[model samples]
Target: MAKASVNSPSGPASVETLTTRGRKTRDALLDAARTVFEDVGFPEARVELITAAAQVSYGTFYRYFESKEDVFRVLSDQLFEDIHHRGPSDSTLSPAQRLIAANRTYYQAYRRNARLMAIVEQVATFNDDFRRLRHDHRHQLIDRQARAIARWQQEGLVRQSLDPEMAARAMSAMVDHTLYLWLVQGDEANEALLLDTLDQMCLGALGLDQD
Candidate 1:
C-alpha cells in the first residue's frame, strides 16, 4: 500500500539512529502495536490505542513511526525474521530426519506467532504491499527448499523424476495451509499427529526412502 506521508522534515528516524532511550521507547511502541494489532486487527487499530497501550503520547508515537501501517510493517518484518530462522543444523542427521526437524521448527514458530500471522493474512487480502511482502517471504523459503531438494536428488536421496521447485512449492503449501487451518481458523488438531503426518507427506512427496 502507499505509505502515509509524514509531516516531519526528516521523516521517521531509522532504528539505528535512535538513542538508547529512544530505542526503548520505540520498542515499547512496537510491543504495544503488536498487541493492538493482534487484539483488534489492522483496520480497527488506531495510533491512539497503540500509544495508550504503550503508555506514550501521540507525539512519542509519531516520533518513532510515520503511521500505523509503518509500525505494522516493522512488526511484520520481525515476525518474518523469527519464522525464517532455522537455527543450527546437525550434519549427522539423515536428510529425512533433517526434513522432519525443519518441519517441527517451522510449525513451532508458526504456532508462537499464529496471532500476528492471522492479522498479516487479513491485511494481505486488500493491501498490495503486505501481499507482496508475504509472497516474497514465501518464495524465498520455497527457493531454499527447492535448492536442498535438488541437492538431495543429485545425492540419490530424493527421486530423480520429481521437479525440485514444484515439490518444494507444493510441500510448503501443504504445511502452511494446514497450520493456517489449525491455528488461524481454530480447527481442532492433535499436535503430534498433525506434525508427523506433515513430515510423512513431505517425505512421500519427495519419494525419499526413510529406511
Candidate 2:
C-alpha cells in the first residue's frame, strides 16, 4: 500500500515514530477537526470544540496537537493532498481523452470539497504561511501537468512549438480559476456542458482537433 505524508507547520516531525495507538488518536483529532472547521470556519474554530467533537479530553487533544490551528492545518494538508491526487492511467485513452478524464476528476473533487476550499481561500488572505503553502501546492500540480505536456510533445501529440512549462502553468490556472468561480463564487453551471466546453478548449490547445 502507498501512503502519502505532508510537511507543514502543523505536521508532526514524523508520524512513523508514533505508536499505533498514538496514530489513531492523531487521526481521530484530524477527522473531528475537519467537521468543526467546516461547521464553524477556521477562524472561529476552537480546540475545545474539536476535543468535544472528537469525544476526547483536553489532555488527549494536546497530546497530539498543540492548538486548534495545528489540527486545522493538518486537515487542510490532507484535503489539499486529495485535491492534487491522480487516478491510475488509462492506456486505452487518447491524449485528449486522458486530459478530459483528468479535468473531470479535478472538477468533481473540487465540487465535493468546495466549502473547505472556500474557507482555505478566505484564510489565506491574511495568513502568509497558508498563502505560501497554497502557492507551493499549486505549482506542484502545474509541474506535474507540465511533465505530462512535455511527454505529449515528444509523442508528436501536442505541438512542438509550444513551451510545455508555460502552457501547463496557463492551462492549470485556467482550470483552477474557472472552477474557483463556479464552486467558491457560487456561479451556476451545468456540469456536463462545462466539462464539454473545457474539453474543447484543452483539445484545441493541444491541436488534437487537427488530428
- Of the candidates shown, which would achieve the greatest lDDT relative to the real structure? 1
| Number of colliding residue pairs in each model | 1, 0
Write model 1 residue lDDT over 22-119, tens digit each, in one string: 99999999999999999999999999999999999877888889899999988998898899789899999899988988888899999999999999
Candidate 1 local Cα displacement, residue 38, angstroms: 0.5
Pairs that clash in candidate 1: 1-129
Per-model C-alpha lDDT, please? 0.92, 0.80
In candidate 1, residue 83 scores what lDDT? 90
lDDT of 2 by residue, 94-143 (tens): 78888888888888888888888988888889888788878888888989
72: Cα error in model 2, Å? 2.2
Backbone clash total for model 1 is: 1
Best by TM-score: 1
